[model samples]
Target: MPQHFLLSAEARNLSPIAIARMSEYEAVMTMKKLRWGEGKDVICPRCGKKHEAYYIKSRKQWQCKECNYRFSVTAGTLFAHHKLPLRDILFACSLYVNAAKGISALQIARDLNVQYKTAFVLLHKIKEALKVHKQRETMQLSGVVHMDATYVHSSQKPKNKKSERVDRRLKQHENPLKRAILVIRDSFAKQDDEQNTKQIGARNTIAFIAKSENSKVVNQLANKHITKGSTIHTDESPAYDNLIYFHDLKRVNHQKEYRSDAGVTNNLAESYFSRFKRMYYGQVHKMNNTYLYEYANEIAYREDTRRLSNGVIFNDVVSKCLTSLPSDDWRGYWQGNKKRVETLAA
Candidate 1:
């Protein structure tokens, strides 16, 4: 049998040790290449000009000739005002891209030998960058789409005494922090010229967080993301029954079998949930409701890029960090500047 893709050497294009060995100058040059490409043009965030800015050798910043505004490589980007060295930031991205499920901030702290708070904020900044870049694309999934919902923070721990334990499955006993991650995945289709007649796997994915998996929220999200007339595959949940009015809906009853006789299945969405559960239960053991959407979207990104090599994923993530604007929620996070509201789908 052929070896798996990730187990092959081609998939191991990036090495964290190489990034760690990079000098400060090499790190800066690398960031410059990723940020501005081969060209020497450096746009001043202040003056908003694409003209080549004067390089300050001592400070390693650019002075825009247009308006005399000075800016560093990370200025105006998600890594703006960063306290860590550029090499360490690049190493962190390498580690992040290599983690298949997800990497915990605690683990990152131990590896980078930084404070837990710093590692936490650094990882969040990366996530926020990814979220922003994905939003900027304004992606809309088409073709064979799979939709499903999964719950987190819904189960309560049992008490030591059997008599003291409450029925957690009961609606009233359910944890109030319970939230659902609604996933919609677009499947990969075979090209017309290809001899393969089978369609397999999900190509792209989008996710949303809600208080619960209800029809109102489901309809609203599906209508917004899924194009009209696209076929949507989902489980036999009443919440998805309403999607039939907008698109061709196919349902497979999980209570009976994973796939129906007609070859209908929501496995694409299930595949996304499988990785999410690994990240949640195995890595990030405790997650608050406030940033649950970010976590979900991160998993979606991982799943969609599963076929790509670590080098490609690393470059894509680094490019996103460079292009994403400074985060409002996490800029002064350690200084008590934080988002007070939770993100929920309407």
Candidate 2:
């Protein structure tokens, strides 16, 4: 529970040389070392066969002596089809993993010296890898827990004269904005986790960006993320009424009192909501629902790993980048993709 040891100035695994390599060609070698291992058999991504491959220096690619399929160091993976340098990719990973509150795409663009569009895609790609790897992890909340649903306003605004006129027409309907999110965090969730312990603590959370907070949706979220027989503290929203069937539901009526007889409250949800909202307003001023949900997942991931060192997080994200597949789901995220965000989803 002490401040994550790895983030301390002396505890970080990143060295001056490594940081220097992040801006040089050595970062590509670092990627290859982490992804394929040093001095090992070359495995063809296309054929899944081991062959002695030769480096085609002119192309900055590899040639499988067997299939003759030529590829760059980042091909056939999450970083495929990228136009940026290899070191810059690793540089972005370092910035993202250690960012406690969260970093903006604009900030990322400035750091990488790339266009906003490239940074947008790059940040999401890293988040997508982290998200894919996190989904493989099984987390269940137990003991006292807090659950709540809140609507966050979108940051999208008009950029041109024509769009400005259209925004004026729709201003009346943008009150509650685009998405509703559900946050599930343990009330006694730890601000930090014990590194050697195997238990997933209360502060750990799972969330979803939802469209509707109906009975079935709320019930399904409760059933999936929370343990079978735990206490659920929430406000008097009717959306949570159906949760009584399984959870020991405790309600706090904000209109009259903040706490009930047994010290029941949704304080954790309020705190988390404030932080997430702040992150949204400060870092991501304009975002669509799919990426917003991805941002929520990033917040949860940050909290869950808060107790660990930044070095640990950096290594974890690097591993995810090498192993996880590229996400095709980001199509139209900022370009008018209006499909309903996942429902009854964890």
Candidate 3:
């Protein structure tokens, strides 16, 4: 078949489903390249002058003529100062983007044949970039927003063993697990006037955090992402007792029954946390308290967007990663590889 004729025939025979699938497939193949040729001149890093640069593919380094500045494409990128292969970085990124739950740094290191520390750093950088993008793009949680809390404790011994001894006794007085607040919007709430009972489906979580389940954090998150007058459902936690001050709070006293005054319950959020806890324990095994928020957000983001195409997720992550780069460098790098990256990620 002629090339154009074959292309046209393919398009003609494509169903709506097939076309959508093809678009996703096209996105998954996108790749980003800095410069194409061996002798292409690049601007000097220090002098800001154009100079003939030679790319040594074997060493993956470039030598500039103007200032004798020698650097690799990985220089200044998230992969900079790392000894891992460029291919490994790319593969890890692909794995992170595609994994439904998430792969641990240990698993990544084992797969890539890199040190555990390298994988840890890479994951942190990627998570930071993801968080940056998420904060930049504000998403509103509408309808019934379920609010609840869970606990995650670190096994690391406290610096003060004396205090730890006291804390152990304190734990006997209270919950042993560290507190983690979970707020999820039931995106599947449907009003039924005829039956007078709203049907609630599986929720798509908006935000999940390991912060204190106190009123302050709850109120702050509510004020930030949730719109005013949205129905907020939760258990009879003292923190959420005052939720009515900012939102239409519906309380479900689990002790008596699981239904609130507004006929709502936090079963969805509870289920979400249950699954989240299992995944965290199963995959990550251990997460530092310092980076808990990033880790939680990463899991939540992946879960919420699991149904999305790998290419779409890849582009989303890449855009975020690019934003973390210097403005000039971002523009230059993106201009060169945006189409290619999109093609691969699509």
Candidate 4:
């Protein structure tokens, strides 16, 4: 039998050990190349210009010709004011993208020999960077789109004394921290002309957080992400009933069967939830509601880029981090400057 793609030698291109062995100068040069490209021009973070900057060799910074602002390679980027070595930062990011399910801050701390707080803040900064990068590259999804919502923090454990436990299924007893992650995935079939067969899966994915899978929020997100007139497959959920007004909607009654006689199914979206659930249960044991959207989006990213080699994924993630602006949300996250409220759609 043919071997699975993920287990194949071709998919194992990156090594965290190699990244760890990189010299300080090598890490610095790599970041500079990723941030500014191979050209001589370095954009001034202060003035936002691509003009030439005076490279201060002694200080390892560039002074903007127009603004005279001295900035290091990470200045004004997601790693601004970073305390960790460049090599360690790169190694941490490598480990992050290499994890198929997810990596917790505890795991990062153990791997990098850093404090738990530092690892927590560092991982969150990477998450924030990925979220922004996804937003910056937003495009309308076309073709077969599958959308579904999975609830997090929705279930409560039963009391040891069964008599003392209330009916948790009731709306009044539901966990108030509960939130839904709505994932919209665009799938496509690549025709193998030689074999006259097709390969199918989700090509792109977009995720959002909402209080619940209500019609208003579902319609709003579908309209914003999926292209008009695209064929959307969903399960038998009333929230998706309204999507038919603007696009072609197909439904599979999951309670009765996984697929309909007409081949209607929401397997694409369900596949995303499968990996997300693994991340939730296997890696991140608990997820706070405030930053749940970022976690959801991170899984969406992993699903979309699953076919790429680890090396490619690492470089892509590092590039996005370098291009992302400094994050205020994670700057002083452990301090009193936490996000005041959860980000949710109506």
lDDT score of residue 318 within candidate 1: 95
Ranking by TM-score: 1, 4, 2, 3
How would the candidate models be sorted by lDDT, starting from the highest? 1, 4, 2, 3
Candidate 3 lDDT over 1-346, as tens digits, reads 4353223433232122332233322322222222222345554455656665675655656677766777765454454555554455556777777556777889888877877766876777788776666667778786778777777772335556565444544535454335474656555657668768553554456555543577777777777778888888888888776678878888888998877566778876776676667768788877655566667677667766644566567656754654454323223332352212110000
Tens-place lDDT per residue, model 4, 1-346, is 9787899999999899998999877787788888888977898888899977888876768899898889999998989999999999999999999899999999999999999999999998888888898878867998888899989889888899978999988999998888889989887667758868565788899888998999999988887888999999999889899999889999999889999999998888898899999999999898889889889989999998898899888888888889998877877878867877776766
Model 2, span 1-346: residue lDDT tens: 7654554775566543365455445676677777777774556788777755887766767888888888766777788877787777887888887667788989989987888877887888887887787789787888788888777664346556774544534646454555778889984534336554444434777878776566777888788788877999999989999888888999999897878777878887776777677787777766666467778888888877766666667777777787877666555556754346443363
> Positional deviation of 328 in candidate 4, in angstroms?
1.3
The whole-model lDDT of each prediction reads 0.90, 0.74, 0.61, 0.88
Off by over 4 Å in 1: 192-199
Candidate 2, poorest ten consecutive residues by summed lDDT: 337-346
Clashing residue pairs in candidate 3 are 27-344, 27-345, 27-346, 28-344, 28-346, 29-344, 30-343, 30-344, 30-345, 311-345
The Cα error of candidate 3 at residue 313, in Å, is: 2.2
lDDT value, candidate 4, whole model: 0.88
> Distance (Å) between predicted and true CA of 282, model 4?
0.6
Off by over 4 Å in 3: 1-76, 154-177, 186-211, 257-263, 326-346
Candidate No. with top TM-score: 1
Tens digits of per-residue lDDT, candidate 1, 1-346, equal 9798899999999999999999988898889889888778877898789877898877878899988888999998999998899999999999999999999999999999999999999999888988887777777788999999989888877899999999887899999888989999998886634755453588899999999999999888887888988999999888988899879999999999999999999999888999999999999998878888889989989998998899999989998999988878997788999888888997
Candidates 3 and 4, the one with greater lDDT: 4
